[model samples]
Target: MTGTGALARMQAAFASAVTDGDEAAVTAHLAGDPALARRRLAIYREAIGANRRGALRSAFPVVARLVGEAFFDEAARRLAAVAPPACADLNRYGDGFPAFLSTYPHAEAMRWLADVARLEWAWHEALSAADATGIDFAALAAVPAEEQPALRFSLHPSVRLVRSAWPVLAIWEANQPGRDGTPDRDEGADDVLAWREDGRVRMALLAPPDAAFVEAIGRGTPLEVAAGSEGWDFAPMLVRLAAHGLLAGFAGPQSAG
Candidate 1:
């Protein structure tokens, strides 16, 4: 076991070795004293588990409020056991948690748990998205017609657009720190537009068309000139993006209306 195979075996051992009750196989392979190897393995397991748990906790603070502390911890622990972290970057952990919660036994009762998880993940992603020097409205308004064609547009890194069938925003707001409100899904579901500008996460409800507009930009659409997307209102889209600082400068595409 001294060649590449040995290295492969060593890697496999780490996952297997980290289990709380198993150590005999891995300890025999290690060069160190058996007792020392077992203890070290235990330490690694605890540290990794703790780090993963903390990341999950941070990603789902709102969910934690909806469910009490003890329940949240138990669910997090179970989720860790079910879906181990795929990347070492703890900041982006729980990216797949939304799908996981969709089937998680304890969370099955809450059909909206998955939606909340998705919203939380989006919030986390928005916080780390590339930053922009907010949309320069003055410059945009000043551009001349001929120069506009060549003008390119880009978005602030913080802009993230999310659309869900669930009344996600209302539910999230209902569980907010100072919210004295009620959950009224029947009122309407919402499209949530979020951006991390001014060093904080800011979110608002978007009309269908406005959401489509931002999504178009996100999918690499140049500042959309035309409006009336599907059945959504363009005014809401314009107003919301302008307000949240999602507008990055738009460059002129090859041609426009």
Candidate 2:
């Protein structure tokens, strides 16, 4: 083999061995001693694997707390084995964790755990999202009534909605530090409205109608269409959204009046 081709092949083999735990492939490429090479590979694997699992633990501390450390660590290892980090940025590595937990055999009895993970991920994203200057509400109100229906509203960059059949918000709140009292297991379905305000991520439980309104707007629906969505009443929900400063801006035809 040419020098360049041999080097490329060795690099690929090394990567596959490191990530896939293929000791035999790596041992074949050892320079001096096979035992030394195995020891080095073992150390590398232990350190890198722990680092990756640590990132997941940090991102999903509540999950760790819920499932306990030993069990959570086992799940994290399994996740890393199947879905190794595709990006250099570890912060973005665990997006599939919630889905993984949902299908995990041990977690099937705790269906709500996955939703809680989703909420934590959303909150994490909101914390890192860009800031937005709120909309000019006075100008929005001043727009001609006839043109209002066509207006397209934009939510704040930090705004995120999490809809689940489980009472995720209540469960999350109950698990918070210093929180007392048991969470009601039968609290029913909930939709969470999350946003960053004053440099902190905050969340509120949305009513079904309000959840539909926000979901419609998030899909780029026109104001009139979102307002007229089934089970939605535009006025109070609009007031609540404005109060939360979620209306980042709007665009539409210029008012003739």
- The TM-scores of all predictions, comma-separated, are 0.77, 0.88
Clashes of each: 12, 0
The residue-by-residue lDDT of candidate 2 on 134-251, one tens digit each, is 8997888788889888888889898899999998888888777776525766577989998898889999998887898898887778888888746546789787888988889888
Query: Model 1, 85-133: lDDT tens per residue?
Result: 7777888778878888888888878877788778888899988877676
TM value for model 2: 0.88
lDDT of 1 at 112: 78
Question: Residue 178 deviation, candidate 2, in Å?
Answer: 2.6
Distance from true location, Cα of 257 in model 1, Å: 18
The reply for model 1, stretches above 4 Å from the true place, is 1-12, 19-24, 30-40, 135-153, 178-187, 222-226, 229-236, 255-257
Per-residue error for 210 in candidate 1, Å, reads 2.0
Predicted structure 1: lDDT: 0.74
The lDDT, on a scale of 0 to 1, for candidate 2 is 0.84
Cα deviation in Å at residue 145, candidate 1?
5.0
